[model samples]
Target chain A: MTRFANPKKFYNLSQKLIPILGITTLLFFAIGLYFALFHSPADYQQGESVRMMYIHVPAAWFSTLIFVFMATMSGVAFVWRHPLADLLAQEAALIGAIYTSIALITGSLWGKLAWGAYWVWDARLTSVLILLFLYIAYLALKQSMQDKPIASKMLRLLALIGLLNIPIIKGSVQWWTTLHQPPSIIRSLGISIHMSMLIPLLLMAAAFGLFFLTILLMRTQTRLLNIKTIALLKKQDQLDDPSLAA
Target chain B: MHIFSALLKHEFLLLTRNKEIFFTLLLFFGLSLFLFPFALSSDATLLKSFGPGLLWVITIFTILSSVESFYKKDNDNSLLSFYYIQKTPFILVFFTKIIAHFCLMISILMIILPLFGLFFGLELKSIVILSASLLLGTPPLITLIHFAIALTLSTQKTGMLVLVIVLPFIIPILIFGVGTVTFYETGQTLKQPFMFMAAIFLFVFAFVPWIAAYALKESARQ
Candidate 1:
């Protein structure tokens, strides 16, 4: 991990891994969609609307997962002053925000079918909405700063503070008598979901995870290249007028 | 310790000199409270029920507006860098500033809120509960706003940016703050929500100054 903290090394390594991750993500989606749409049994209570879970659940999982990832990278960037960590975190913010939006929209759609309301002030839904706002805040803060290094530093602190929402979002359903359902798949004792649903759900989660990684690498690479271009342009300006270097 | 007291005195002096913030906050609070009745029905029972939530919303907007100006003069003059150069403990300065701001704003709020409550036809008991919850809840909310301002000090537009960033984080405080009053009205023990609000205040009180100080330093560096 420390070795990849170097941008050059990360760039080289990610170049090779991106193709593999992309292909695996495609493969997972193909298999997961097949099972999700055709193979899995209809939920006795929810009927056809239960099918929304395949996409909604995975998107929700990735939303939280990407935030945790960004926060971790933020910590790494702060502690180690790793440029790659900062880049990864910056790239992850938008992806996380997109996934969070996906989760909210799909969850609302699912709610319309399952709970007979388009929205509810349920703890789970409210907290997820807050999560989306946090992501937007992170992105806006990132964009507002003119200084790159300073922005990174402040954003690192913001990310760490924002991480408090993750646990709250997770525990919201249990903490309050929410209309949103409680966690059924991952628990302390064992999986509560049936194997039929669990398999595709897990597969779809993997697909989303890989998709996040692939896009993250691609975005980070572009950012790094942009940084290098700016550096080169500054150097050229310095060369053109040596007095400007002072 | 002397430096801290001096800082507190200096902050209070500055705050007193800047009466515009206080007046703006008062007018904003009054107008928002006034608008609520016009926007919603003016039925006494309905207004009484809506009192706590309306007051909390006004409190949030006031905090956001007031705290945005707390660091304005310093940031404008780049005085923050001077503090760093002198090795002044920013955490102490920030805490003093926040305390001063809280004392001024919350006192003004306490005075005006009861009148708003009277206008809304809230019972004396509910008014007392609302004031107490505001007292407990406002510190953490101000601390959070202070943190948001510190974080976005480098940005051009701090007001809406601070709101967008800070509102979500403050929801829990708002929840428990409003919850305390609601619970009281419902004849439930206010202990739970009151304690929760106090706990949030304590937590933010202990740690947010350090974070805000760090952000101040970072933004100052820029």
Candidate 2:
């Protein structure tokens, strides 16, 4: 694992793994969509629109998962002074925010169908909006700094502070009366599990997780290349004038 | 301790020297409170109901304008370097500055609350409860504003940047704060909102200072 911390090793590994992640992502989504949209029975109450759950729930789950990943990468950047970790965190935050946005929009669409209003100032909704703001602020602050190291540390500090909101967001539903639809997917085992619906949802979730890793490694590889390019350029300039090269 | 007090003194002196800004913010607070009657429905009932929130919003902004003095005063002095060498506990600096802010906010509130009461036709009894809530609430106000200000200390426009950053975190405080005065005015018992604000105050007091202290330490190293 430590050896893979080398950008060269990571880059080589990513090159090998992308085709696998790519093919599997395509296969999983295609199969999942087929099973989800066609094979699964419509909800007795929600009718056809309940099909939105397969996408909405997994995306929401992925959004939270991505934030945790971003936070962990932020922690790594702070503790070990890892330059790559900093970049990984920045990218993940943007991606996580996009995921969250999709979740909220889709949730709203579903809410309009289910609740008769497009928006409600509920505990769950307010907390998600707050989470989105935290992501935007983190990204904005990170970009605003001109000093790389200072930006890294400042953003990491911001991320850590912002993390306090995450648990609040997660628990908001439990703590407050809200208009949001409660957990639809994570039911207990004895509750007549439908293997048909469950398999596709789980597959989609796994696919998105692998998809995140694939893109993260690809971005990391590009960043490593950019660093190498700058280093090469500097060395070339030195070679052009040996007297000052030392 | 000496360095922090010195920094605190420097911050206060800087704030005092810019009496125009200090006065402008205070005036903004005053005028903003005046808008309460006009902005809300002119029905005395509706106006009375929402009056406390406008006053609290004004108070928060007045505090925000002054809190930036902590970062801005470092412009000529390089006090962060001075404190770095002095090895001051960052939280001590944080608390001292927040204390100064609380003093300013409270002074502004003291001067204005009665004015808000008289002009807006506020119920006197509820005003008293509202004042009690403000007294309990303002420590956390200073504390969180300092935390937010420190975190965004390096933003190009620190004032607006922090306003954007902290709005969500401040909402819970706003809910309890405004709820206290509004509920009290509605002839209901004010116990719950008061307790809620107190709890929020304690939470921010304990949490925000530590975050601010850490951010200040990080900013100093730069």
Candidate 3:
């Protein structure tokens, strides 16, 4: 794993892995969508709208998962001073923010069908909304700072602070009298969701997880390339004007 | 301990030198409180109900807006470097700063809360609860704001950036602060919310200084 800490090596590895990951993500999505839409049994009560769970649950799961990943990468960057970890983290913030928004929108739409209100100031809903704000705050702080190294350090600190929210989001339903449902899949009672529904949900979750990784690598690779391009351009400029070498 | 006291005195002196800003923030707090009745109705019942929440919200805004001036003078003069050169621990500097700002916030609140009571016609008990909640709540709020200001010390437009960065974290403080008063009004036990507010204060107090010190150190590097 440390071997890929070098951006160049990571770039080469991602060049080969991207295609494979891309194909698998598409394949998993296809199978997951089939099961989710056609094969899985609908809720006796929720009926057709229960289908929205596949998209909403996976997006919600991945949104939190991506934040965890970003936080870990930021920790790595802070402790080891790994430049690649910093780049990966910076790239992940956008993807994580997008996933968060998708989860929110899809969850709200489902809420309209199931709860009759498009929005409610429930613990679960409010916590997820705060999660979205945390992501945007991370991105905004990153953009506002002019010093690259200091910005990375500060962002790592912010990410660690924001890590406090993940547990809050996970436990909001359990901790408060919320309109949102309690954890059905990961509870100690052992997977309350039926196997038919669980399979597609897990498949979709796996797909979303891989898609996140694929996009993260692609984004990081492009950023790495952009850094190299700037260096090369600076060298070319200096070579053309010898005085500029100073 | 002596170093901490000395640093605290230094911060207080600096704050006094900037009394203009000190009064301006108080004025801002009072004026914002004054506007709420106009925005809503002057109905005493209504304002009384809205009073605690509005007070907490406006306090948060005042903190956010005043954050720029709170740190600007010290940062501009590189007082952090002076402390560093004196071999003062960064965390100590952070603590003294937080203490001074907490005092500043409390003083502002002391002056404004009675006016708030008069305008909203809050009972003595309600005003006392509001004051008690603010006392417990403002430490964590100040620490978070200081952390945000330090983290964004190198950024342009830090006033707004600090708000965006800090507001998410401030949500819990706001919830528990207002919860303390509202629970009392509803005849629920106020102990739970007050305890939560204390826990938040302790958490922010213990951890944020170290993190903010790291930020201050990083900013000084440039």
Candidate 4:
């Protein structure tokens, strides 16, 4: 991991991994979708509407999971000054935001079918909404700062602050929800899902995880190339005029 | 101790000299309260029910707006470096600044809140609970804002960025603030949300100054 902290090594390594990761991602999606749509049995109570769980649950899981990953990378970037850590975090946040959107949309659709409303201020739903906002905040903060060193440090601090807030947000939302609404009978997961449903859910989650990795690697590579191009241009300009060095 | 007291006195003096921020904040708070009825239904019961949430929304926005100016004068004049040169702790200065700002802002809001409450048809009891809730909630909210402003000090546009970053983090305070009023109105014990808000205040108070100081140092370096 430390060896890959060098941008050159990371770029070289990711170049080889991207194709393999991309292929596996596609393969997993193909298989996961097949099982999710066709092979899995209809939920006993929810029936066909339960199928949305495959996409929705996985997206929700990865959305939160990616944030945790970004926060860790941010800590690494801040503490160790890992060369690719900030870049990885920046790319992961975009992917996490996309996943969060997917989760919210799919969850809304599922809610409309299951809970009779497209939106509710329910704990789970509201917390996911907040998660999406956190991602947007991260992106906005990154964009607002012009100085790279300062921006990275501040972004890391924001990420850490965000990390501390997530559990508090989740806990408070849960407490608020339970105070208002009766306990939901259909536990989204945990002792509710059967073996048949669990397979596709896990598979879809794995596929989504793979997809996140592939996109993150691609985006990080593009960022590295961008930096390289700018450096090369600056070098050429300096070579063209000796006075430019001063 | 002397430095901290002097810093507090300095911030208060500056606040007194530049009275525009005080008036602008008060005006914005009053205008937001006044506009609520116009935008929504003017019916008394409706306004009463909406009062706590409206007040909180206004309070959050007021804090955000006021915090933008908190560091602007210092940043523009490069006055923050003076503390470094004087060998004063940045955290002490940052905390003193936020405390002074919080006291001033919350006092102004509290003074004007009764009239806004009467205008919105809130009962005397509700107004008291609302004030209590704000008292418990505002410290943490202000600390969070201070930290956010520090983090965004190096940014080109700090206003919206700070709002975007700080809003979600502050939602729990909003929830509890509004909840405290609702609970009081419903004849439920106010202990729960009040305690929750107080907890948040204490938590942020304990740690946010250090974070803000660290961010201040980093921004100054840039």
Candidate 5:
């Protein structure tokens, strides 16, 4: 865990990883999209519209999945004051919010086609909506505080708390009667989803994960440069101040 | 008589003087609800079922929108330099400001809930229940908001950010706020959410002001 404590070491590691992650994401999504759109059979129930599930389900999974990951990263930043952790967490938030926005939009579109209703206040939908709000709140807290240290500490506490909604979203179907279905392949009994469908779903999920990694590394590099720039400006201000010499 | 009137006068002036702030607060309440029609589908049955929760969420946010306004005023232009020298007990000043904000929030909700009901075609009984339900639910929420506002006082421009951070802490109040109206509308007898909210209200009112008072003093020192 502390191996990432050094920013230089972390940056060097990320520098090596960026290319590999970018290519893997590219390869996985290319094959996954092919199988998802053409090869997979329709759900015996929902028919052709079931195709949207491939995109919608994975999109939903990554959104909540990445958010919880970002919250954990926020904790690392706040607890250790690891500069790399701070950069990575900030990067994760921006990417995670985008994931949530996409999931909501896609989920709504999928609902429109499949359910005859555009939106439902079912526990599942409401819980996911709350998840989106949680992301917005995290960004807001980050913007409000000027001191980065204090902001990190504050944002971490909030992220950890907001994250409780994740379980509610995942379990809402079982806990309450909701329009959304409970997890099928990931839960209970043996693997029910056909390999043709399951393979691409898992592949897309992996691609999205790598995509997040690639973007987060790029963001951290930029943030590191910004911090160094600020430090340079502070040193310049001290050097230029003549009155303080006395 | 002199000291009491002077403090009351100060608070009254603070509450009444900010026309822009007042307008902004009202606009926030109105506009937050206004977004629903555009974002949500224009279906009546859906709105009927979802309306209470949506409106409650909006009111919670509108009150949150203004939590920083008073703190911003007290922290004017580095003039906080003089706050320490002033004779009024800072705690009293803090409580007075919080009361002023709460009054504004309650008044806004009173006027807006009915308007919301009319716009969304909710029944009169639902509106009445909503009004009472919101009143019961809001105090603890506002109390929690004020506590967080005071703690983050030293860090200016924390408004939206502060709301997010404090949001989870106030979940019970929100859940109960939703539950209160749901319980009333359903005519169910579980009756626990409202009582739970009242207990939380008492807890917040008892502890929050003291915490805010301590934070206010520390901030003024800074």
Candidate 6:
């Protein structure tokens, strides 16, 4: 892990890994979509709209997963003062925010079909909505500050603080008796969902997870390249004006 | 221990000397409350139903508005770093600040409650419940506001940005704060919501001072 903390090393590692991740993500999406749309039986209750769950659940999972990931990276940065960890956390936030919105929109669409309302103030829905807002807040904090070191420290703290919301989002259904369904995939009484549907759901979740990793690596690479380019430009400017450099 | 007391007293004195904060916030809370009756019809049932939530929301606005005043003077004058350089125990300074601000907010809430109750036609019992919830809930809310202010202390144009960052975290407090009274009006027990508010208060009071002190340190560092 420390080895990858060096930007040059991480950049090289990601360059080799991106193609493999990209291929796997595409393959999983294809297989997942085929199984989800063609093989898995529609819910007796939800009918065709139940299919939306394949995409929705995975996106929702990744949304929360990415936040926890960002928070962990932020914690690493906070404790170790690792600049790379903060950069990874910052990059992860953009993807997390995108995934959160996707979850909300898809969840809203599914709610409209399944529950007869485009929106509800139910516990699960409301908590996830708050999750979206938290992501936006993180991104906004990252952008608002002008000083990099100060902003990085502050954003890491904010990320850690915002982590209080994750458990609430997870337990909203159970804690409040929300309109949203309780856990189905990992229950005490074995898997509640059918295996046919489960396979596709897992596949889609893998695809989404890999998709996040791929994008995170790409964004981190771009940011590092941007930093290097700026440094080189500064060095060139100094070379052009020796007196100013002195 | 003596230093802590002295610091606490000093914070209270500073707050009292800047008496305008209390009045401005009280007036702001009053004016915000005044707008609601006009905006939503004067129907007693509607006001009665909306009163708890409205008061909590307005209180949030007041808290957000007062956040700058709470830290701006010290931050602008570099008092925090001075305290840090003097080895004054940064956490103690922050904790006392939170305590003093909490006391000030409670006093403001106390004065406003009767009028808010009368304006919204709340029963005496409901007023008591609202007070209870506010007492238990406001510590976490205020600490959060201060924490948000500390985080953004070095940023430019932070008024709205602080709100954007903090409001998302305020949802649970709002839910349980309003829940305490609203649930009672509907013939439910207040114990559950009050318990949750207490839990939040305890959790926030324990951790926020440390993190907020760290934030202040970081801001002062640059």
lDDT digits (tens) for residues B72-114 of candidate 4:
9888887786666666788887888888888887778877888
Model 1, B15-108: lDDT tens digits are 8898887887888888889888889999988988888888898888888877867788888887888888888888987888889988887778
Task: List model 2 lDDT by residue over A1-246, tens digit each.
Answer: 557766677779889998888888888888888888998988776789977877887888888787778888888877887777777887788777887898899989988887777776666666777778878877677666654456676677677657765764445333333222444432221245467778878877877777777777777778778878988998998899887687
Chain A TM-score, each candidate = 0.90, 0.85, 0.89, 0.94, 0.85, 0.90
Docking class of 6: medium
Docking class of 4: medium
Q: Can you write out model 6's per-residue Cα lDDT over B115-165, one digit (the tens) per residue?
A: 998889999999999998998888889888889988998886789889999
Better of 2 and 5 by TM-score: 2
The order of the candidates by lDDT, greatest first, is: 4, 6, 3, 1, 2, 5
| lDDT top scorer | 4
lDDT of 4 by residue, A1-246 (tens): 698899999999999999999999999999999999999999777889989989999999999999999999999998898858988888788899999999999989988887788988888889999999999999888877753767878888888889888988987888677767744743653456679888998999999999999999999999999889988998999999979989
How close to the true structure is residue A59 of candidate 1, measured as C-alpha lDDT?
92
Candidate 3 residue runs with Cα over 4 Å from true position: A168-191, A237-246, B1-6, B81-87
Candidate 5 lDDT tens digits, A27-79: 98898888888988887766777677667677778778877787778677756
Estimated TM-score for each candidate: 0.94, 0.86, 0.92, 0.94, 0.68, 0.92
The docking quality of candidate 6, as DockQ, is: 0.59
Error of 5 at A153 (Å): 3.5
Highest-DockQ candidate: 4
Alpha-carbon deviation at A193 in model 2, angstroms:
7.3
Q: Local distance difference test, per candidate?
A: 0.83, 0.74, 0.84, 0.86, 0.70, 0.84
CA lDDT, candidate 3, residue A161:
85
